[model samples]
Target: MLSSRHLIFMEVARLLSFTKASQTLFISQSAISKHIKSLEYFYKTGLFERHGNHISLTKTGQALYDKLLEASQLQESLHQEIQQLNETFRPPTKLAIGASTTISLYVLPSVLSAYLRQYPNLQINVLNRNSNNIQNALLAHEIDVGIVEGLTQVNTLTYTPFMTDDVLAVCSGKSPLRGRALVVADLPTIPVALRENGSGTLAVIDDELDKRGIPVASLPVLIRLGGTEALKNFVLADTCLAFLPKRAILKELAAGELVEVPIQDLTLQRTFYFIQRKGTESNQLVNTFIQFTKRHYSNRE
Candidate 1:
């Protein structure tokens, strides 16, 4: 358990504003000031130096803040572990997972269903967003785990390679691009449907094209869709080509509603990541689910 003064100091250090920290911690501003003063007096050092309306941590304060953060994390982890131990027979574990639109729509449902069958007591909640938003959520401590495409360079997060997926160029059967091998240069002339910003599929497509000295700005985008289903629907109804995850359009391809076209000089393969914050312990349920997903995909491959 953290002392109230220490917790208040931690919140103020993180927010950098006594008023904001007060509102966040549901304490009065005066109380926040008293706590800060107490901490500063005990250490005989100025924690925060005031400059107009802004406050910044001093060197000593920064060191203390780092120590406080580590202590708070350890306290939380200990509490969670004890709770897990208390409910030995049927532990109630809640996991909040963030995923990109493509993985959430096409890949996660069956995997989650199978996981639930094995651990029926675990409660799972999924938040579907774009890759960037998923990363943001993980950083903000809003989600326990994230599954995203492409590589992320957030130093605080640890990424494990979960699986690889291919993005295929697809169009309606009636479209002219169907039944043809299209080259990279040809993509600029065709009206393409694209996913919105922050989407993993869109990011990979843009990155791959850039590597080949082709700018995404060169492509004439006919439409921008928010979700995978919307993008597939746009391609199915219009004469526009879309780059989509192969898993997303499997049923459409099988039913002849959409046709896959090979793109020359492009192999849009992306590795999906299982991401979690570094130093965070994985609960038994999370560990089991991750293992199951790995085994299931490995057997399929």
Candidate 2:
């Protein structure tokens, strides 16, 4: 457990706003200020430098903040170790996961079903969001684990390669474009539906397109949607083409409700990763689920 003053300082330092920290801690801004003043008096130095409404940590404050983060990690590690050594301790009863849209809607349902059967008493919660939001949730400690597309350079988190996914260009079976493969040059003429700006699907599509000198902005976009299912439904009901994960549309493709529109030189593929805070990799429940998921997918291949 952290001291009250240290806890207040940590929240203020992380947010860099006394008002925001107060709201996060469910306290008043004046209370936050009082704690910070006391910390400064104890340390015999200012922790933050204020320029108008903006505040930044002093060098000593940064050092203390870093140490506190390390201490938090250490405390968690010690708790896990104690649990391992105690024979009478019950296993963790809850798990929270955050995943991007595609993984949440398509890939995880069967895996989670099997996992729950194995651990009948464990409760699971899933948060479905775009890739960018999933990463933010992990950093904010809102989820115990996150699985998302692509890797980022956040040093406080650890990413492990989980699987590869392919994105396909597909259109409605009844559309005029069905069975007609296209060249990259033809894309400018056909209206396309895309995922929203922060989506991993959009990011992967744009990256592959850029490598071929075709910027996504150069294409004619008919609409932008927020999730994999919404894009798929739009493509099903409308004539616009879309790029979607292969795992997401296996049934639609199999039923001939959707047809793949192969582009002459374009193939969009990306890796999905398991994300966790750097210090929590040894967490038994998370690791168990990860290994089980790997085995589940492996057997399908």
Candidate 3:
């Protein structure tokens, strides 16, 4: 059983409202106040500062809240594991995953099918969003694990390399530049499409171009779309080129629907990473899935 005082304090800290915490925990407002008061008396310091209608945690309160938040998460994870172990007969193991657009669309679907075959008892939920949003989801504890193509690191998150993605410039099969190699100087002449800002593809593109004495904004950008599929569609309908993951355009390349445009003296690459909140690697479900993904990609290499 969880300590009532600790649980009540955590709820109040999370919600920043005694009234809301009481509603959430299905207790009386007076009871909530009583528990908080007792905790403050023991700690000998104020945990929350109350205004007319709102409340906020003090520095000491924030530190205690962080610790208690981790403890709550551990408690939930522990209960899940124990239940799984107790009912080996038909254990329900759930794994919720958050993924960026590139990994969710081009990479993980195939991997998940095989994973499910091996652990049919496991239930998996996937949330596909932009790389930045995926990181936010992990930080918010909305998902168990995340896979993203973005290389930006959050200090409180861990990024483990899952696979390498080759990003290539491509155009429709009918484009004049089809199957042609171009010099860096020629990049300025061609009309180009780019992913939306803050995208992993755009990030890598920016990095590579910056190293070559060019800025992405200096390029002849025809359009900027929010996702790979939109950019691919726009490119196929017009005489524009885009940098995309090879995996994303493999079928198109193989079928001759799109052609890779070679850039001399430059190769753009980004790694897809497994992401999790710091200290979450010790979680059983997270550890299992991370190890599985790493082994799968390592064997392919």
Alpha-carbon lDDT, every model:
0.84, 0.88, 0.83
Question: Pick by TM-score: which candidate is best?
Answer: 2
What is the alpha-carbon lDDT for the whole of candidate 1?
A: 0.84
> Pick by lDDT: which candidate is best?
2
Worst 10 residues of 3 by lDDT: 87-96
lDDT per residue for candidate 3 within 1-301, as digits (tens), equals: 4588997888788668988888867999999988888988999999999898999999989998888877867775876678678855454566879987787886678778878998898888898877877788788766889988856699999888788889999999999988688977788788999988768889899998888888898899988998788888898888788898887888989998889888899898888889888877778767887888777756766
Find the number of clashing residue pairs for candidate 3: 0
- Residue 18's lDDT in candidate 1: 95
In candidate 1, which residue ranges exceed 4 Å CA deviation? 1-76, 79-91, 281-285
User: Candidate 2 clash total?
Assistant: 0
Q: Clashing pairs in model 2?
A: none
Candidate 3, after superposition: displacement of residue 150 in Å? 4.4
Residue runs of model 3 more than 4 Å from their true location after superposition: 1-72, 80-91, 298-301
* lDDT value, residue 29 of candidate 3: 93
lDDT of 2: 0.88
User: What TM-score number comes out for model 1?
Assistant: 0.73
**How well is each residue in 1-301 modelled by candidate 1, as lDDT tens digits?**
7898997888788778998898877899998898899999999999999999999999999999989867866665675677667856443456779998877887788888888888787788799998888998888666778889875469998888888888999889999887889899898899999999888888898898999888888999987889888888889999888998998888999999999888877898888898888877454445666788888767767
